[model samples]
Target: MDNLSRRDFLKASGFIAAAFALWRCTPREVTASVQPAPTPAPTLATPLSADDATTLTRTLRRITFGPLPNEVARARAIGLEAFILEQLNPESIPEPDILAPFDFETLEMNAGELLRVDPPGRPIGELMGATLARAVFSPRQLYEKMVVFWSDHFNIYIRKGIERALKPVDDRLVIRPHALGRFHDLLSASAHSPAMLYYLDNASSTKEKPNENYARELLELHTLGVDGGYTHQDIVEVARALTGWSITRPRRFFGGGGEFVFRPRLHDTGPKTILGQSFPAGQGVEDGEQLLDLLSHHPSTARFISTKLVRRFVADEPPEDLVTRATQTFQETDGDIAEVMRTILTSDELRASLGGKLKRPFEYLVSALRQTQAEIEPNRALFRYLTMMGQPLFHWPTPDGYPDVAAAWMGTGSLLARWNFALALAFNTIPGVRVDWDVLAGEASAPEGALDTLSDRFLGAPLPEEARSLILDFLNTLDAGFVLPALGALLLASPYFQYH
Candidate 1:
């Protein structure tokens, strides 16, 4: 599949119009580890459907970063539910090949080891590079997708001092391990993560005067929905319950210092009532642990988290019926993430939400790389381009990560930026990345034949007739050498292509 020949290209051209348009369509199930979501907003574009191959490919488009042909084939071979089960248990999949070559220097480092390194090694850069590389090359697509979701849900700004070093370790230890495991596990891991402590100011929270930063966000943002019905006093009580849950900053290890610590002396060992539940007067670290337990199982937490999951995988408004069903799954299973994901993926809501999502800037960039099979490296180009496109990795200044709805990202400027990127990538113009024209073009040297292959490659089925004609007319004006590549670019930048 990687090396395309003239014969194969000709054969693929014949498949353009028939691959996805109206012909014997049937729906199928999908899997998790997908992308963004925010508070409910507008519904999405027209949902596309065709035959089994088309349905499977489109479903893969939802769960994975732009579906590679090989991934599509594997899904067909194994069948949907089996493949989703494998993705849910990423441990069953062999380790990704990226582990050795794309190594981030601080991946194995604890907070202390990272602090000892000179200049800090740009570990954040290496970590991000690895992340993008995995998006492109890893077979553990659903696992990687879940990591993206959890990373955003428990976001930590990398620009902060120690966080530059600590965030990568947090990704390695806390987030990735439990991304698809269980909600309670994910919440507890975030609470214990030194990076989270540092980012939220919980590290300095004390018994005498506790900080409310983490406490407020933990209720309003993390667990309960904004309207989840907690009061100011509840926030204060939650803050008091979290005192002395800090980092061990003493200079003990060679790499410098910082580990999760429970300083009993600094803790407020007083009676506390949170959400109408009482805590005994003298407890230690268990006070905070119990808080996590309470919040993770709360009815509001279940609904809040269920709504986000539904939005991320299904649609913008998140079907009321689906949210209620998923909430029950969350509560019934005690926050089992994998089961909840399966429930969401196999629902009628997802089947209706075929082409309903607008790709966020990050998804747009990463999916382009995945489709074009770009040879990306850890460099300033990705950072600059990602920033310019308006969704720099882990750089949202506010605690509420990048807006996941179309309204926030559908402005004229961001759309134009996306178009420019599509053109540059299709034309092989980006530095340090190569777009193989031969592999992309195949036997289609002329504009007409080129459109068939281009549509087949990018849009899965044939391009709609109107789009096909406009693209063909546009290609005719270009020089002979430019037609095939330009055809690829036009298809990528089209409005229809943006929704999936």
Candidate 2:
């Protein structure tokens, strides 16, 4: 049998054209209004019917990168509530030693130690590899998901000067430690992170000329929404309050530097007012601490954080009622992240949003690797695909992070990149990444049976009737040797697999 060319692959997989046609014809706008209140949280103790099992599958799909058969079985066996509760408290779950095989030396180093490395880019590469490893292989799936969430929430661009060294430190010390902790503690840790300070120009801030870059983002992007009711004057005052929050400069001979340090001399000794709250004179780091307290506990912060969480896990435009409930939980729990996630995850809103949220490039890639059980080297060969798909890890230039909306990722170029990736991965063409069709598909030899097996394995359920028919027809056209890889590529690139 001749090896299939790219043109032959696309021609054989007619479902891509059909899926694109359906996508273009369908209205992407969601018009559902927020319910006045949430329906009572579903009781999980009931027996599992087909519909119940499907719901459980959807829940696992949303929370983890993608659902494995074992995970799906575990969720069904443990029941929904227990599964969610167990994921929320990640410490109780024993994690697989996902990083044991990789020798990423810089992941454990401080910024000062990273700066001294011979090749400056190695640390960033290792960090990205570790991140992909965790997402693809970690058994503590929800915890890894939250790590991605907070990494975006408090974004720091790695390409920025000194940030290349500092971001790994920030990821290890600041983001990972506090991802599932209290929001206040997370905010405080980020405020003091040298990567964040340097990336946002707060490291150079002084009493004489305070930089407002970090302060503006702190208010607008990190905590409060754009409509969170603050003025430019508040930004100025907050920047003033955050003055002297700087990192120690790396010395030439000694290996001591890159640590956060507060300079009392550079601090604005005078009193200041922020968000209508008064700060007395002679305050130092307390100014920033109090400011974080004010923002973290504010009603607007609760709403803002809740709305973003709901948007991430539920829908593009968050349902107002779910946001309200999550906000109430946030306020009630003093910004406890786990509890707020519990409120949103257990609500009726997420249940209704099954297959509604589109996977961004990173999610799409990681989910594919997870679902296929691909053995990956976690190197630039794999990372380059994400770069091509428009979401290079830790590399979004702005503070807003990668956009979470489906529209941001639906470009023709991005879609083509996804298709190319599906082909490469399915054919085992990517260097250092391998997918075994025999193991993944099992004893299914015929095209029809293989299609059914692949569909159930990838989608966590049978494909829709129309989609199944289109794909099976495509498979029937291929020669016996080409059927499995073609079917695998077609399913991975299909729209059914694009959404969670």
Candidate 3:
């Protein structure tokens, strides 16, 4: 996973080969030649053999944010096992027109937008809107999800004004392009992204005034484990090595290229040691590149990153053996993400841990959108919902970003916010998203029937009879119109529905 070796691998194998080669092997079922047309949509209720359930769960969680009605049907038609393989190999999947609704060029805004007529109204809102729109409406669901995953990994704060606007571009360029590619390239790209540079203060970091914020988090959060055996001196050395890497001012530079520019004058010429390895001295930005290489290939990084992937898709506390296996794959494959994913997807650990991890706020938002067949017009609602859930888009306050642990999400206030969100989403109270109330209502009879249909629509199966009865009882005292959305919301917020 060293930079030189990873780049060499890319050069030797081509980008496609680099991506696939880095992926650890997955034991996938042979794809049936007769793939089904994309219609009638897939669902969990579709009779799956016991063997298919494990594959189906992985496909639903990883292939896209969550499976919409049509997507679910397509999975059933193609066979769940084949669908998982296709998602893992996204390059083979033709680029789908998911961003059609988003005007990526004009929609972009940074601090410059603040100087406009309405200074108080920031274009950051619009930037977030475009992002959410793409996530919910775009056909390239897997890419969108990976973008989200990497965003959290290299979390930046959008509240930083103009600089925050660059994250979308960074996502498209730095993160998305190599999401499933080699982990080393991805690490280097994130390090050099204008968004990361500015957000972490690398833009202002100088030899005399080294900013350790990005450096510390880069090790603690981005690459090596929080418990990685690095010291304060190591962090300071890493920061010193990164001094002089700044972004071109949008207004001052080459027509807003807004890219990272290395200033040798601002860089530290003094030799430094990071992770116990000393650079001979006199290297400038290349020193930082070398540092990233060292960190990317570190044994701590492999285990740390692998455990995170497991947490995202498998279980809260993934098995030690699985993590070891994934870490081994990461090392052997030179940080190939697809290869690491192949290892996890094909393992007994993940298969046994399926349905154990609670879906995060962003995951919940995407899943709700998928289940209800909601149409995204502006995409502001998705961003708004994410904010309401305390996970605003590109707005993590610290360089360390949002937490992955369940404790960060639980509590009375957080639970209340989630309940309110669930209700609003189902009732169509949120702006820019539409749901078919009539179609939902027509599926069932009494309030219980309505509840049952809602369970199927949002939860992927019929409601538990007791849960159905409880919802029906709640509905008896309310209007039917109110009943359906309320029940729909309740199911979405259900404990059972929280985990994938």
Candidate 4:
């Protein structure tokens, strides 16, 4: 495997030669994190011009969960464009290592089975655990990142009645597979998913009393964003067009039970107008289907989605040129997410926005796990911190999803919370989370050597002289029993680590 380049590794996984007759599974090797050399190669602390190094680190941070010790080496070896391409075409990559400790049974269960499960938190726990595990360990970092982004985009509360059951199924069938695929495909799938139907109360919608909850969100949140020029009448018209697009009863245990169902009897068979486009009387499910088609391809929708992508990848305000370029790519490519992402990742604006965005709490936790290479078997306590920081997975409680910028998360109290977790993690006191400081330290010893190792592993470079001296002075106050772990914790808690 060492001799094989990433391309060759993918090509050779099934056979020695393409013309040869053979079959094989994608090697389990593709899933696990590739261990770097015990000692990092001797290299300049900062190898490029200040701006270029900043851009490179920013690229790695945006694409991956966080920076790894060997991230720069690997990206340099492959070239940044090629690295971005690999992540964009994730099918060419193999499946990630399964979370062996997790059963995943509840996620796979039918809606009826999930609704019947007596205990509630088990499904939520499994889903959250899997989310953290994948972000920290999967080799296909970009794909996992997209899955998370979409989960938020189409958020549903796990504790909301039948949503506790429908949400996991929605994740598996609708969100994960299409996260990096076409926007139209993803939009269509979410429109037909049971969890969404129930959570938004579209299942109970009828021609007699149309529920505008799903329709309003579909226009304002899902496709055409709030400023996408939709009127209240358009929302009502969309509701009329979507009447009877719903799910079967959860009590049904057979056939397409608890699945999407269009009850023709409940559908509005009268003429309707959405965004000034008219639907003739006597139409049924096609009315809603047509509405989905219109919104997915609307020019406003393309701009809205593109703006959000640019904001997430580059900066909160988003550079106008990048947005213009990305919106053109989105409309030209018919919302090909991969191409849109490529446009943003390759842009000068994204590079220029270095260190401009702050890490969200969810990002902080996962980055901690990835940098430490901790042994993570999901436990209840591990997820409690997520709840505490107010970014609980699949629990945003509204359609807008969690905020992506820095100001929303900069409270002194939240900073203190992160510091506490960082110290606890390094001390090996966080239940079910374990870090191997001895293995991480290798042959490095004492204050100077340990700080060097910690900086190399976590920051990919040394800290400022003042910060380094501060940590060293603090170490002088501690005993041998606490010195090593406490120092590592201090590194994790540093302001540098807090940002990227």
**Candidate ranking (TM-score, best to worst):** 2, 1, 4, 3
For candidate 3, the lDDT comes to 0.68
Better of 2 and 4 by TM-score: 2
Q: Across residues 420-461, which tens digit of lDDT does each residue of candidate 2 receive?
A: 788788888888889999888899998778888888788766
Which has the greatest TM-score? 2
| lDDT for each residue of candidate 4 in 132-207, tens digit (9 for 90 to 100) | 8888877788888889888878888878887767888898899999999999999999999989998899998999
- Residue by residue across 1-500, what tens digits does model 1's lDDT show? 12335653343233232222221121222222223345322222333346777767777777888888877788889997777787888888886568576646667777777766666646777778878877778888888888888888888888886787688888988988998888999999999988899899999999988999999999988999789989999999999999999997724256656778888998999999999989999998989998999999999999999998888777766788889999999999999999899888878777666766777887888888887777767567766777777988888876777776776886767765776676667656677677887777687777787778767666666655655666666566566766665566556666446666
- Compute each candidate's TM-score over C-alphas: 0.89, 0.93, 0.81, 0.87
For candidate 4, the lDDT comes to 0.75
Off by over 4 Å in 1: 1-49, 250-253
Top candidate by lDDT: 2
Candidate 4, pairs of clashing residues: none
Clashing pairs in 1: 25-50, 33-145, 33-146, 112-255
Clashing pairs in 2: none
lDDT of 3 at 293: 90
The parts of candidate 4 lying over 4 Å away from their true place are 1-55, 69-72, 252-256
